[model samples]
Target: MREKNHVRNVNNRNEMEAVGDYYLNNKTLGKGEMKMEAAMKMRIADIGDEIVSNKGIKGKVEMVKENSVIIEILENLSDREYVNNRTVVSHKNYVII
Candidate 1:
């Protein structure tokens, strides 16, 4: 009885823990544990800069704001969920291509 319970617990724990897979791709994540891209902070994004959003929406930067940038949708690699031609994406949500 006790042996069977231990086996189940072990299996469950193993399934829940996948910590070392690229750090970002993990099931066992704690607070403040994150890795940012170098281009996200170092690169200066500007108007006409091509970027791909986190959701795989490809677009050009139409305007730049303090926190986010206005993008004109050029190509959507994901799906047709985006019904608008222009979108506002945060700096953290996209990378300049």
Candidate 2:
């Protein structure tokens, strides 16, 4: 019984470590899609929040030439702007938050 408990503990620790490693790698590699997914999953304002790309971390529209909004992203430190109302090309590094 003691041996079985030890094995279970090890397995639990391994699973925890795997989850930690996955988050660490993704955080370092700067996956834009992952960041966008996380942002979209957040319940900041409310459900059915209008997703717009303009000049803010979260905007109501994508493109506003006047007074461009800038949001500082923790992950994916790429120099890119989210233009409102534009379809993003796949495999490109742009934050659609």
Candidate 3:
């Protein structure tokens, strides 16, 4: 029984390490350096500016949170429905137009 438990623990640790390596080195998974088109930072004053996602979702900034912005999705690009249709978009995942 002890040997079985030890083997299970080893397998779990190996699986966790493999997952970590995948996240840190997989280019397809958005690892490593990223491209930034603009160097300007998003401020509270730019809350009303139009923003777009890579997936073509257009929305206006409703609120700004720590490291993310709350957008009231104005278009019908997404199928999911929420109360007033809001989504928390990451600052890196969107562009202010």
lDDT of all the models against the reference?
Answer: 0.55, 0.27, 0.46
lDDT of 3 by residue, 35-90 (tens): 13222433331578666543435678988777878887876343345676677777
Instruction: List where candidate 1 sits over 4 angstroms from the true fold.
Output: 1-35, 38-42
Alpha carbon deviation, residue 51, candidate 2 (Å): 21
Error of 3 at 39 (Å): 6.1
**TM-score, each model?**
0.56, 0.17, 0.48
The candidate scoring highest on TM-score is: 1
- Number of clashes in model 3? 0
- In candidate 1, residue 53 scores what lDDT? 61
* lDDT tens readout by residue for model 2, 1-97: 1121111122221121111112222232123544454455433322222332211122233232222323222222123554443332211212232
Tens digits of per-residue lDDT for model 1, 1-97: 1121111112322121111111122332232232244232435469998876655567889999998999998876554466789988888766565
Estimate the lDDT of model 3: 0.46
Worst 10 residues of 2 by lDDT: 13-22
Error of 1 at 89 (Å): 0.6
